[model samples]
Target: MSASIVCSALGFRWPDGDSVFTDLNLLIGEGRTGLIGVNGSGKSTLLRLLAGELTPASGSISITGELGYLPQTITLDATRRIDDVLGITAQRQALAAIESGRGTEADFGVVGEDWDVEERTRATLDRLGLGHLDLDRTVGAVSGGESVLLALAALLVRRPPVLLLDEPTNNLDLRARRLVHRAVADWPGVLVVVSHDRELLDLVDRIADLREGEVRYYGGNFSDYEAAVAAEQETAHRLVRAAEQDLRRQQREMIEARTKLDRRQRYGQKMSEQKREPKIVMGNRKRAAEVSAGKHRNMHLEKLAEAKDRVKEAEEAVRVDEEIRIRLPHTEVPPGREVLRLSTVELRNGPVLDLDLRGPERIALVGANGSGKTTLLRTIAGTLAPVSGEVALKVPMRWLPQRLDVLDDRLSTIDNVAAAAPDASAQSIRAQLAKFLLRGRKAEQQAGTLSGGERFRASLATLLLAEPAPQLFLLDEPTNNLDLASVAQLTQALTAYAGALVVSSHDIPFLRCLGITRWLHLDTDLTEVDPM
Candidate 1:
């Protein structure tokens, strides 16, 4: 029941003066905690602060035990041996010296009582399905998925009391992801993991949602968190409607009071002019009437103000995740139109492709990390050419690369969209950009500084808003680093897109949401499979 980590009045901001956290306070106890937020919501930054990788601008952090961190983007000396990654190089060297019968007292001290370090490391790696890999092999020789498992194995061997992992499941295949889930499930100490992988999040003890500059805890897995938010939003919307009606009623009552006062004033003026009473008596009556009218107007004014405040409070409680509802009749392909056809296309890895894609077909391209899925996407995007044969595209096509490098970093998002859409006016582009949640100065900010989710949104805007109105969309890992809400937004946007889609992703849920009509597994060849 004790808190393993605590933050009090924690404040931090980037060097560009962009504030991420202000007076943020949190208490993370011992549990499997899933840290989730939008791409640029400072989830990773908070982990860094807790790990002491970055210093906070203000406030303090308290920790009860040793802490370890696995960052979002791991930078490893790929050429180094696996032992070096596991922090056992010194111990292995000591053990070797002792075995050679030339060990000093210092060597014995280094080895200490932990003589089974090598065995434990091997067991951890094997449990993660990396048993086939040689312990002496360099990390550069392994696959990307293997490398992720290796990094996780590195952390597992440490057994730190407090572990912070940022996007640990990113770039991992299905098997590796399941291994990570098991690791999180079996973890005994305080573990906080930040990931977009829904399967991994399903293993957590509780969910901590970082939004609007604070953390809100939900007492279950990702599904529970989503259900809670849905219920809250429904209630908030109902309150907003009720508040709107109350405000209107208050305004109506205020106007009626003013009308009655006006009528009484006019009647009093006529009575005074007709001299219905003595001069002093009429004057006294007028004064009393003036005081009564003033009181009545003030009461109505206060009621109206109170009603307006209630409406504002109710509106503030509702989230503003606006959907992209732009209509693109120009991009819709005819039912009989031939979208793409590959004729005897020889791929890099000996896949002779003969495929035909008709109008508005949604295809999910599934493959392993090194199975040439990305290469195929680049070929379709015209960024790369196959070793032999031609990739024929009958309609205008646009590619959203896995890295999302389509945008110019130095340019603002508004400018980036304008670059892709030369024929559209700036005002028109801004209006469309607002649908992507980039409004006003946010649209004007340089693309280089946007959050991960914001960058994805900006890149998506550029592709969908291109001048030619792309009839074929080539999306690579489109939902990679997106938070759940942003992923929902992306799904809503793609639902409205009336074009053919070829998406490369391992996210089954997201692929299902796309309404994929065809499923193609790209190994040595691209072959269609049943959606089931």
Candidate 2:
């Protein structure tokens, strides 16, 4: 296999004292590559650098094939039609062709080969399960998930030799995720994906772990990478323990030698004084003995330092602490038995849905995109007034909105938290925020500047620690931007929460884990089922 992309001895340091990598090297061949790392480990940074969106501070990155990158955030003009967006790229290329009109007769002869361009575009759309969508549909009317699928379809039409996708499955539903997986599996070129989805990683030929700004290659899928990491950590631990043992032994031996040497020196001086031997000879013998003892002490000291250094090095080789602490606290106040009561609630151009959530029941709002799940959530949370019926929330509700509109774009994280819970003292609020890993000066950073996952966590912290706390939670797409670990953490917290939970999520496994058996499917014809 030929090398498609290569990064040699790369190093980067951002202005915020964050290190991307130091002396990192990687080689990519013609196959699917998966990038896995903890949150904020520079996986996205590396992708940006490879896509020529960001320049590295040092070292070089070279791509052998035509590269096309699909960023985590897809951007499309809201007013533009799908056909216009798709054709814009082709039109630009055709314009370039027209500008450089020095083509041979062969080019003109084969110009008719473009006859099936429309057919090919349709096929691409169908492959993505979006053939039914009108090409003339305005992007503004499309949902977030559809926008992503459309972006992918447009990129595929370019037919570059290499595809670099960053978290392609993040917001996609199960069916859309399957479509992406199929596309990656069947793609005829090099593919590199940065995703936290283990299922998606399983389709890759190799996994590249990004940590501390360096890449460690492991052959095989996610399971293999995890196994290799475990084994390596074990080895590092063993080495550390052995080094500690050797250091202890050496210290004991050194102490004994020093005590014996002291005794010998004292005895020799006493004998010399008692026997009245030649003073010079006695002094010389004593000096030689002292020199030998000093040398021995120095050697032992060097050995001890070396042993300690080895242990430190071994400790740095692997991060053995991987457990998550989900410390969610609830107040003493309990909500009434009636959580939410909705009767004859009709959403615009959508279903008339009715829901009754009693006690601490976990109910999932299940529907396709644009099916008014979020609208229903807003209505129940008292944020949006319904057009037709009434929603009686017996107890005060806390809402994690679909877009987190409560979060201020201009305020710092700490200020945002303060704004939400004005009664809580600064010290207490900071302490609570620290539990979610936003500590020290990070609380002063702008909420808008944080990553999508971090912002979600901050919003969650605000609700969990509210003063007049809400017992009923209305979560909309809570798992949209969370990493897998964070998702698990949130799941554990929600499972432990002793209040009514009404969550709308695309994560099936997460919903199942929450014991949400009842679902209200919102479509033109409303349906409710117990899909336990």
Candidate 3:
């Protein structure tokens, strides 16, 4: 396979002079590649550089053909028509003009050979599960997931040789995610996708792990890459252990050498003080002994230094996947305790239904893109009034929206949590924040300056450490855009929560990790469904 995207000596830095990549070189060949890394590791930055959306501080990018990019945040003008977004409004107009016998030479030239562009566009939309959308519809009329699909459909219609997608499956429901997975699987050209969706990643031909400003390729899907990494980590751990043992041994030997030198010096001093030989001969012997001892001490010191260096190098090879350690005993509800109740409730633009939650039930909300999962969550949380119904909460609740806007941007992470728990002392809040991996300077940093992972952690800490100890939690698309490690950390934190959870998300793998007790499908109505 020939290379489709080539980056040479690529370097990029933020305006604040924080370098993301330096002297990075990469070559992506003709196949689907999943680009994965922790948040702020520059996976999305690399994609933007490849798409020419961002200029590199130093280096060059060469693409074999036309490049198409779908950014992580798809912001389309509300007034723009779908045809305009697809770049086919002019062709469609020209075709209509020719059919009405009002076509000019310029219109004919624009139409060229794409007379069937409308048909092709419709087919692409259908493939992406957006067939309900019409070319004349405004961008604002669709859901967020639909907007993403629309952008992807535009790329498919153009049939660019290189396609770059950043978090493409985010905000999409399961059905839409499947559609994207199919599209990625069937892509014939070079496709580089930056996504945290494991299911979507499993469809790729290879995995490109971007870490420490370098890209390492694994010859398979996400699972294969994970297995390879696990093996490498096992070896790394073994090497660290061996290096540590060697370091300890070197320290012991150095200590023993010092002890022997001290004993030798004491005996030599006694012999010289006792006048056992002529003063001149004794002085020369003492000088020779000192030289020998010095050489021995230096040799041991050098060995010890070498051993410490080896240990440091070996330890650096290991990767750290920190887990969130938190215990919320106060949030636990007794068995059979009523946590929440919705009596004949009509959700805003959603289903009308009655629901009851007891104890610590973990419910998974599933639906299509426009199926009103988010609306239902908001309604349950009392942020949005239902059309006509009653929502009664027996216990305190907290809502974590997909946008993660719960934190005050201007407030420090610790202060944000303090705002949620005004009764808690600053020391107590800092202790809790440390469990969420926000400690010391990180806890003092403003929410606006935190990275994606750090922001999510801070937002989560605010919720999980809030006053009143929430017993019912409503989380909407909680795992969107989260890296695998952050997802794991989230799982760890949520696992420790002894509260009722109503989570709306399309990520099946993450839902499974949550140990969901009940699965609810939101559509025309809310219905209990089997685990997916």
Candidate 4:
């Protein structure tokens, strides 16, 4: 069997003097593999490199089979129909030819010899839970999740030997996610998936962890890999501590030896100054003591140097997890009983919905694609006026739009924070930003120049620095572009916040972790579920 992909000494660096990877080596065989790393650790960049969409700065990459890629972001034309978009026309032709029992040259060209393209298309679509999709429906009319499913369908038609997917289940619901898992398991070719979903990671045969421009492979599923990493980190920490103790002991010994040598030299000088009888004997005694002291001092110095080296080695080997410092001012305002109330709310061309939110309630809005979850949040935030409803908000609310529309590209992170938090003093605003891990000069950098994770941090700085921050937080897809570190930080901060939290996300595990007090599930209408 040939290798699916082989990358040796692969490396890449950006024009801004930032290195993504260096001297990286990887081998992908015919099996399900999971790629795990922090955001900006070059997961997507590596995928693109594998797909031949990007060139490696150095080294070599070889691929034996045809490769297909599904990027995290899919670009679909608004006017094209779903079937036309996925090349189903050829499939229809193949179907017609089979039913008529007629063989033509065009049929051979449309679909290669033995493969029944139409039957395959039907099977693939059905596996993706999209068999009922209207073939003529415009891409513009489809929801984000629908477009994602359609893109996968298009990829299925290629029937490539190697498949690379970036965040394949990002916008998928539970059912759709299960379908994707089934497809991946049934795939006969090589598969490399980059995702944060632990359930998906468990399905892979092995795990590759990207860190500090290198890939470390573990021959097991996610659970085994995670356990191994934890054990390694623990051992590293132990080594660091032991090395530190050894260095301290050596330093104390060296200090004592130096003190003894200095005292002996002083006594010898005093004896010479006396200039009494037996000058040769005094000189011999002084010289012998000096020699012994010198030898002892040299030995002590050598031990000290060795200890320092050991300490340095241990420090270099230790690694700590990254955390985001998202800090907001502590407010003492006594929140009212009713945070928000919606009565007789009806969306355009949709069903009637009513909601009552009490003090500091954490609510999760759930729905399929094209549902009015976003619309309801916007109406509550006073961005979009509802067609007909009685909406009430007791306190000031800050809305984090799905796309983070409030950020200014031209302004620096500090300047943007200053603009949103005008009432806050410069020192206070800077302090708040530091909590979000945008420290010192980074806060002064322009917002447009930051990475996706940094940009998210900058936005958080702006929102959290505001004086008397809106007690009611409305976030839509807050975890979309964040890295794993940032996601953890955000989760911790939200968990500790005392204000009312309302968010909409497709991340099932993250939502469950947030302890959503009330869940409102909407298809064409709204249905509330009790705590599970």
CA lDDT, every model vs. true structure: 0.87, 0.78, 0.91, 0.80
Model 2, range 1-532, lDDT digits (tens) per residue? 3539899998777888676787889888788999877788788888898999887888999998788888999878899878776664344344346449865555444444564556788899899988987765777777777778888887787678888999998878767888888888887788889987767888999998876667778999887887998899889889888888988988898899899999999989897979778888898989999899989999989988988888788778858434324454453224347777889887655568777778777788777777777777777777778889888878767888767666787887788878877988889888877767777877778888887667777777777767566678889988775666677667766765677788887667678889885776777745776673
The candidate that wins on TM-score is 3
Q: Which is the leading candidate under lDDT?
A: 3
Clashes of each: 0, 2, 0, 2
- The TM-scores of all predictions, comma-separated, are 0.91, 0.80, 0.92, 0.89
Residue 522, model 4: Cα distance from true site in angstroms: 2.0
Q: In angstroms, what RMSD does candidate 3 have relative to the true structure?
A: 2.8
Q: Name model 1 segments beyond 4 Å from true.
A: 1-3, 90-116, 335-337, 349-351, 408-431, 439-455, 530-532
- Model 2: number of backbone collisions: 2
lDDT of 4 by residue, 84-112 (tens): 87887775666578568885877766666
Cα distance off (Å), candidate 2, residue 145: 3.1
As for lDDT, the candidate ahead, 1 or 4, is 1
Tens-place lDDT digits, model 1, residues 1-532: 4549899999999999999899899889988999998777889899999999889999999988888888887777789988889888889899999999989999999988889988998899889998887767777777777777788888888888899999888877656777888999999999999988887888898999888788899989988988999999999999999999999999999899999989988998999899888999888888998999999989999999999999999999898877767677777998868999887877776677777899999999887778878878777777778888778899999988878899999999999988898889999999999988899988999999997878888998999999899999998888887887788888987888899999888887789899999999887778888883
Please identify model 2 stretches exceeding 4 Å from their true place.
Answer: 1-3, 10-23, 54-58, 77-84, 87-116, 133-143, 251-289, 320-326, 329-336, 402-434, 440-456, 509-520, 525-532
